[model samples]
Target chain A: MTAALSTGPITAEEWGIVSLSLRVSAVSVLGAAPLGFGVAWLLARGRFAGLVVLDALVHLPLVLPPVVVGWLLLLGFGAQGPAGRLLADWGVTLMFRWTGAALASAVMAFPLMVRAMRLSIEAVDHKLEAAARTLGASRARVFATITLPLAMPGVLAGLVLGFARSLGEFGATITFVSNIPGETQTLPLAIYAALQTPDGEQAASRLALIAVGLSLAALVTSEALSRRMGANVHGL
Target chain B: MGFDIDVFLQRGGGQIVARFSSGAALTALSGPSGSGKTSLLDMVAGLVRPDAGRIAVDGKVLFDSAAGVDLPPHKRHCGYVFQDYRLFPHRHVEANLLYGWQLAAPRDRWISLSEVCELLGIGHLLRRMPGALSGGEKQRVAIGRALLSGARFLLMDEPLSSLDALRRAEIMVLIERIRDDLGLPILYVSHDRNEVTRLAGQIVHLGAAHGVAFATDMSQGEQGKACA
Candidate 1:
C-alpha cells in the first residue's frame, strides 16, 4: 500500500470512478446550463401570477434534503413510475445507471445554477433593451446580444457552482441510482465504498486528493474566466 | 414623411394634452421644463402609451386608439437619440453602432456604418467601451447608433443638453451636416430657444398653460419674438 501510494498509477478501477465522476458532472452541468438560463431569465424578467409558484418549484432542490430529492426522482422515474415506464417502452432506461447519476446530480445542482443566472439577468439594464427595440432588434435578438452578454459573469459563476455541486453530489445520486461499480460509482460513491472495505485506505486517500485537486482547479479556472468575461462586457 | 399627433397623457397633479402636425425635415419641439416634450417623444417612439391619441408618421398610422392600430417601437421605423446617450455599456462603440444596423432589412438599409462613423467622427473610437468615452464622444456614438439603423425619421430629445458649450456647438454643426447629407426628417426636442432657431424649419411650442401651438416659415428674430 505504501509502495502503491509512493509512485504508481491509481488502479484502473479507481481511474474509472474518477472518469465516471467527471463524465456525470460534466453531462449534468452542460445539460442544465441552457435550461437553467431560460428558467432564470423568466424568473428575473417575467411578471405573472404563476411566477411565484414556478420560482419556488425551481428552487425546491436547494431547500429539500438531498435524499428526499433523490427519492422523489426515483418515485417519478423508477420503472414502475409512468415516466420511467414510458422511457422503458422507448428503449431508454435510467434506473440504477450512470445516466441516473447524471440526472440526479443535475437536479441537485439546478437551483444554484438558476439563482446565479437570475441575479445576473436582473443586473442587465432595461434601458439598453429599450434602445435595442428602437433600433429594430426583436426581443429575442436583443436578449441574445445584450442581456446574455451582460449576464455572462453570473452564468459562468453558476456553471462553476453547479459543476462543484455535481462533483460532490452524494445523497441524491446514491438514493436515485444506487452505487454500482463501473456504472454509477462516482468519486464520492467510490470513496464511501473504500471506507467500508478493510484495505481501501490508499484508494480513498488518493481519490480524496484527486477530488480536492479537481475542485480547486475548477474554482481557479472559473474565477479567471468570469473576471475576463466581466471585463469584456463592462471594461476595466 | 411627417408626424401628426393628438395625445393626452396623465401626469402628476395634472393632465397633458399635445396636438401638432409636423412635415418639415427639421421640426423642433420647444417647450418649458414641465411641459410634456419628452413624453410626446416617448409616445411617438412607442415607449409610452398615450391615454388617448391618434399618431401617424409620414402617412403611416403608428397609433390610433379608435382604430386599435398600435405598432410597437421595433416596427415604428424611427431612430431615437436620448439626452443620456444610452449606448450599450457592454458593447464597444462599433457594436453599439451596429446594434440596429444588422437588424434592419436589406432594402431598408439606408445608412452604412462607414458613413455614420465618418459623419459622427467616431471611426477612431470604435474599439473603445462606452464607459471610457467622454460625454461628447458618447453622444456622437449615440447619434451614430441611431442613424445606422434604416429608420426614415430621427427623434432627438435634448441630445445636446448634457454637453459643454463647446461640445454642444460641435454637435450642432454635425447635426446641420446630418440634415444636409442624410436628408431624413429629424424631430429635435429642446427647451432652448436658441437651439430651436438654429435647427428648426418649423417649431411646435409646448407649455403647461397653452398645451401646444405651431408656427412655420418665420425668420430667427421673428421666431424668437413669437416664442417669447
Candidate 2:
C-alpha cells in the first residue's frame, strides 16, 4: 500500500477502461440520435393534446436523480422485467453488460440532445417548407432537404453534447451495470475506482485528466462544426 | 391557363371573401395593403384552407368546400413565388431549382432544368447559393424553381415588392416573356398600379373591406383604360 511515484505509460488495464469508455459513449450517442431527432421534431412542430406531457417526459432525465433513472431502467429492462423478457425472446439482453452501460449513458444524455435539436428544428422557417410544398415537393422531401439541412448545426451540437455527457456518466452506469472492469467502468467510474484504492491518486488523476481532455475535445469539435454549419445555412 | 377562385377565409379579427374567375394568361390581383390578395393566392396554392367555395385552374379543381376536396399544397401544382422568395438558402441555385424538378413525375415535367434556367436567365448562377444572389437573381431562381417543378400555373405573391425599381422593371419584362412565351397562366398579386396595369391581362381589384371587383375584358389594348 506504499504510494510510489510511478510516471509511466498508461497501463493495459487503464487502456481497457479508456477504450471501454469510448465505445460505450460512442454507442450511446449513435443509438440516441435518431430517436432524439424524431422526438425533437415532434416537440417542435406537433400540435396535440399531451404535448406538454411528452416534453416533460423527454426532459425528466435532466431533473431526476441519476440513481432513480437507473433504477427505473432496471425495472423496465432488467432480466426479469416485461421489456427485458420481450427482448430476451429476441436474444437481446441488457443486464450487467456493455450495452446496458450504453443504455444508461444514452438515457442520461437524451435530454440535452433533444433540447438542442428541438430548438434548431423550431427555428426553421415554416414558410420555406410551404414554398417547397408549392413546388410539388412532398412533406417528406421538404423535411429531408430543407428542414434537416437547416437544423443540422443543432443536431451536430446535440450529438457532441450527448457524446460528452455519455462519456462522463457515472451514477446511472454504476447503478445499472455495476461498473464491471472492461465493460461498465467508463472514464468517470474508472476514476472513482482508482481513487478508492489505497495508493491510486496518480492513476485517478491521470484518468481525470483524460476525461477533461475528451470533454474539451468534444466541445471544441462541436463549436467548429456549429460554426461551419451556421455559415452554410445562414450564409453569414 | 385560367383560374376560377372563390374563397372565404376567417382570419384573426377580419373575414376575407374573394370571388373571381379569369381565362387570361396573366390575371392580376391588385389591392391596397391589408387587402387579402396574398390570402386568395394562398388559398389557390392550397396553403390556406378556404372556409367555403372552390379553386380551379384551367378546369382542374384544386379545392372545393362543397365537394370536400382540398388538395394539399404539393398536389396543387401551383408554383408560388413568395414575396421574400423562399428559396432554400442552404442549397445552391441549381440544387434549389432541381429540388422540385426531381420530385416531379417524368410526364408531369413540362419544362426542363436547362429551359427554366434559360428562361429565367439564371443559368450563370447555377453554382451560387441563394444568399449570394441579388434580389432579382433570387427572384429569377425562385421562378425557375417553380417552373421546373412542372407547375400547371403560377402564383406570384408580390413578386416585385421586394425589388428595387430597376430590378422590378427587369423582372416585369421577364414575367411578360414567361406569360407570353411559356403561356403558363399566372395569378399576379400586387398593390402597384403601374405594375398591375402594365402586366395584367385581366385585373381583379381587392378592397380593404374584403370586396373583390373584377375588371374583365381588359386586354392589352384596354389595360390603360382600365387603369384610368
Best by TM-score: 2
Distance (Å) between predicted and true CA of B4, model 1? 1.0
Error of 2 at B54 (Å): 0.7
Residue B185 in model 2: shift from native, Å? 1.4
Native-contact fraction for each model? 0.81, 0.81
> What C-alpha lDDT do the candidate models reach, one value each?
0.84, 0.85
Residue B170 Cα positional deviation in candidate 2, in Å, after optimal superposition: 1.1
Give the TM-score of candidate 2 (chain A).
Answer: 0.93
lDDT of 2 by residue, B1-228 (tens): 388777777777777777767777788887777777788888899888989988899899999999999999999888899898888888889999998888888998998888887777888999998989998999999899888888889999899988999999899999999999887889999888888888888888777652433223344533222321
lDDT of 1 by residue, A89-187 (tens): 899989899999999999999998999889878877787788888999788888888778888887998899899889999999999999999899999
Q: What is the lDDT of residue A56 in candidate 1?
A: 96
Q: lDDT score of model 2?
A: 0.85
Residue pair clashes in candidate 2: none
lDDT by residue (tens digit), candidate 2, A115-134: 88998898788999999888
